[model samples]
Target: MDRDMSVEEHLGELRRRIIWVLATFVIMLALGLWLAKGAFDYLQSIPPAADLPLHAFSPWSGVRVYMQFGFILAAAGTMPVVLYQVWAFFKEGLLEREREATIRYIPLSILLFLVGLAFAYFVVFKMALYFTTTVNRKMMLEETYGITEYFSFMLNILLPVSLLFELPVVIMFLTRLRIVTPRRLQRMRKYAYFALVFIGTVITPPDLISDLIVAIPLIVLYEISVFLSGAVDRKIRASEARGSLAR
Candidate 1:
């Protein structure tokens, strides 16, 4: 961060950041394991999991389910830490104001993630559960769900949507690194919409309103990402111009 680092120092800094992130992950993973039972019970108290009776066909079914929740919970807990570390790693390149702006993402990322988790769980996951259950019932199939299989389906649906909620943060971080620009995000807007819409349609109940409800927020997040990226880019350019003028 002194901006006088040799290549070796840069590598060493990166290594330290990685270590910190990993350490946080490990600590959170332990906490997650300790809390998984209560969390697991809470998940079961809700719909979908509440409706389905869990069977443990394999001896490892319970363990696998525990691990899944633990891992995701740890990842979620570690997210803010990761963002801060990333910001620190690139500290030297950023102006003081820019650095402050970037650091604010640490908490905002947590808020966004919690929002994503709620949306995914309460909205998308429920709709998906209803659809699949309805189909199974319509086909006159007996619905017996293995504990492992259920969490697998649940997590698969939950994790991606929740993570996509972090798109804006990820975009902002990359923008800070000068890896992606506002213009680049703008160019990809159409494709991004297509993909997000596809995901929305796949997850939601097959209704126009439902699709729009899910897709719109995701689309809006993308726009926000673009906007924030542009904001940071403008700041960076303005700072450079000032430096050049001073010189």
Candidate 2:
């Protein structure tokens, strides 16, 4: 809906987007039910080792696992479409430059998300698995894991990290809007550290090593966000200055 549109019009647009998202989910779920095996295999690939036994607690847990896996794939595939719809809905209120800037952030956002997903897969998942299974291995245990629980754990580990990976894009947008200055972020360094540590503890498993591993990347990402924000702010200001000069 355009800015001139009434509240009813905006509500109509929201309803429409919601319908689209729901329809997408239904279609994906159906497809997922049919193709759960491949989906499960793909999800399993995120872990470092393949030999871990996966058991289903319920009689139909296998079906549930595959269906859920399909849904996950569907959600991932539809992310860009969802984001585009969101952008379209909001674009009318933005200046041309702002619209362009937001459009530019889309690709970077996707890239950052993928990076985060990879980080979760490569770093967190492996470490978590190692931590959990190491003790069992030491005890000479078989370590049979329930399929649903394992997948749920995997989701918990990956989803947050993937979401976290959007730090750069977030900081970039804030920088673009001048909501947060580079110097402001720099000044908040100590606070950021405490927050990162807190976040690491909250998200990771109870072990100190896991907490430390997760925290390090988060801190590094924060620094990266600050640097990128500084660069973006400089570029936006330079562009604005050039525009003023031309005018």
The most accurate candidate by TM-score is 1
lDDT of 2 by residue, 165-202 (tens): 89888888777667899999999999999998998887
Best by lDDT: 1
RMSD, every candidate, angstroms: 2.0, 2.8
Against the true structure, candidate 1 has what lDDT?
0.88
| Candidate 1 C-alpha error for residue 51, in Å | 2.3
lDDT of 2 at 159: 93
Worst 10 residues of 2 by lDDT: 43-52
**What is the C-alpha lDDT profile of model 1 across 1-247, one tens digit per residue?**
6588998999999999999999999999999888889999999998878877999998999998898888878987888888888888888887788788888888988888889989988888887788788899999999999999888887877878888999998898888889999999999999999999999988787889879988999999999999999988898899889999999
71, model 1: CA deviation in Å?
A: 2.1
